[model samples]
Target: MLTRTRMLAVLLSGLCWTQGAWAQGSPTGPAVVATIKPLQFIAQAILDGEGSVSALIEGSDSPHHFNLSPNDRLRIEQADVLLWIDPKFEVYLAALFADTAASESSLMVTASAISGLTLHRYPDGELDPHLWLSQGNALLIAQALTEQLACIYPDKAPHFRAGLDQFRSGIDKQAQALQRRFSNQHVADYLVYHDAYRYFEHDYGLTHSASLVADPDIQPGMREVLELRETISASSPACILLEPDASPALVNTMVQNDAVKRITIDLLGNSLESSANAYRQLIDHVATGFLSCLNI
Candidate 1:
């Protein structure tokens, strides 16, 4: 599969750029590329450069449901380093990297390989691969990327290490700030309109039982709806966290129960928040949103 990606390198670097930028390969330093926006954002934060880091995934698109285009294949091939979450979410990426591991030597980093990660299994018992939500896991991710970047660009080891240390310290500060602000809140559990918070829950010691949809891309069935209603009634979650793309009807049903209120959980930057500042900013937003609603 990676061989095919390598073969397909004849396409374009997966980053959405002017046709001119895609045509121009790296002039200097390692060309760090990632499969998703969050990974790309983290890499950019730690590894400062002018077009040195690139993202293969587009904004506002879910990596779980991604289909590799010709451009995506090329981006993998051209990348000196490719960082991604576990193969579970981007299953195709594993096969791509595995096939070309010998030839490409892309110096890939797998986000889930880090120790102390908590599992969020589906009914079928598979690893939920959205590790970016947890502050601790994001730290682990930054550290791993820093180490990998050192290996790839040994000349930049000092710079990369310093940046990484700063990144780690920044993560700690944000976590502490959130702890200080939210310490009084005993938010043991909440109900998500979907299953995107396992990593967040694991990191902050929060428990979340989501109102399961029959399929991530589809609606919940009657039985699933009834079960969720029961969960909401019994749990009395502070608010029902609803993603922008999630079904409004499901949220409405739960909120109308009088046991829960509807709260917007902005997963992506919309008309409200802009492009995104740092990895920690996303975590801060999560903490702020939950705290604001829960404290209410």
Candidate 2:
């Protein structure tokens, strides 16, 4: 038979022991998920050691054509923070965004949340969502992401800020170097398979005189193709730019003995492994592609 004081002491001892074990358990950072590779690269740079960063969409699949898998849905649902471009950029994510925006997990960050962005509008009044191509926009994105991450992990705010600063410094130098590289080349006429690089052209002061298709998912009409052919015949653009995985047959047919240069530029960074410098590598690759074609 235990005395009252003994029973109280035993209860207190067990409580303390349980708490000690609980405290011994390691703490984990949040699970962060970005919708695309570029976003993942930015997040990985900022989160580095704080938490793991992952992208839901990968490979050569354009974000415009990506169909979310069950695993992707699960990843989004489980994420402590979910980041993506505007719903207009990723139309497939519109429904999931609606649900999440309505629920408690409104952690989705968009370009609108970032400052100092130059938004592009089409003749039909649709906003271009490829703002990530601009290095300035990348800085704004890092700032917005760092702020959100700090809110989620207040204790780690300094860490996130430091990462962001490093990213800004690195990207700034890369952008400047790219500008210098392009500055020496005489402005040249170019053609593209899609209208996705307007932001890049705008940022770098280059011109894409013609585009075969307005949308990547939709096949260009014969009229549009013929118009592009005529434009190329008339202008004799220095280069025809295609996406990384674009069909060589179609590309060859478009240029068709015109003796024009053909180069592939990857907007999605699909060929490079995702890392802190992946964004820079993507920009560098684009610069190299442009220089190769334009110099010819």
Candidate 3:
């Protein structure tokens, strides 16, 4: 049986042939848009200098509450290729794609729909849309993007393939280094502000003792907070991983022990500039944040 990656490569090759030749090499190439920063980072790496890539949601904006303005809608409509995680992750874009002709476009690539992704689920069994947190998933996403871009710009196919090779090499090297670093240390108990890092934690052999809330958009109620406090008291977690914008006051209220370190991990890469290396940097930042709070 063919691997999913091999199957996807075959499908993409057929797409390139059926779509026919595209006019290549305009001033800036195609306008590629990603719904969020992390997706944008992957596209940036694959596009390299071959094209432009931008995110619809930037800075500290949470996709859960992001509102699409008229300008944002126009950008999506005008984009040659649009990449996003899933409809469930970016609920704002779900309706637009559902109602508009954009859904029919061959250029629209939803990462969730991509083959061979190791998707996770919440305890209640809802699809976990944070698939990009895994380096393996990121490589698969890059492969899909590279094939799609190559189809659009046959002239730039070599550059896009080269970009994909470079991205895979960088990610593999970084993952190996992280695995080595983590192998030497004993697993430390930790708590998370929310259950956003399941993919990351699973990838690096780390696990959180408890999560204050399942949804980042929802704050923990009194009952949930009390329970979390009890768990903290019982486990004495080495660290409590907080989101970049998470309130330290809440953690302070739950944790009175000074030895319990608080570390802010930005899964969205909000502070980093857009570059080919941005995805790798994001992974490194997350790993360093975890290592810092460890007892070692």
Cα lDDT of all candidates, in order? 0.64, 0.72, 0.80
Off by over 4 Å in 1: 1-27, 116-124, 186-189, 234-236, 267-277
List RMSD in Å for every model shown: 6.9, 11.4, 4.2
**For each candidate, how many residue pairs have backbone atoms clashing (under 3 Å)?**
0, 0, 0
Error of 3 at 105 (Å): 5.8
Candidate no. 2 TM-score: 0.86
Residue-by-residue lDDT tens digits, candidate 3, 1-296: 32334334544454652232233423568678898889999999988876678899888788888988899888777666778887788888876754432233325677887878899998799988888899999999999888877777787889999999999999999999988888767878988888888888888888888887677666778988888788789998888889987877787878878988889988899888999999999999888988887754
- Of 2 and 3, the candidate ahead on lDDT is 3
* lDDT of candidate 1 over 1-296, digit per residue (tens): 23444322321222211222223334577677777766776777677653366666565566667678897787677776678776776776777876544354465566666556555676778776776777677766776767655555566768877777877788888878876776666664566777777776666656666654635678767787777777777766767676767777766765556656566665532322222245667676777777766762
Output the worst ten-in-a-row residue range by lDDT, candidate 3. Answer: 17-26
Q: 103 in model 2: Cα distance from truth in Å?
A: 2.4
Lowest summed lDDT over 10 consecutive residues: which window, candidate 1?
A: 10-19
Higher TM-score: candidate 1 or 3? Answer: 3
TM-score, ranked from best to worst = 3, 2, 1
Q: List the residue pairs that clash in candidate 2.
A: none
TM-scores for all predictions: 0.79, 0.86, 0.90
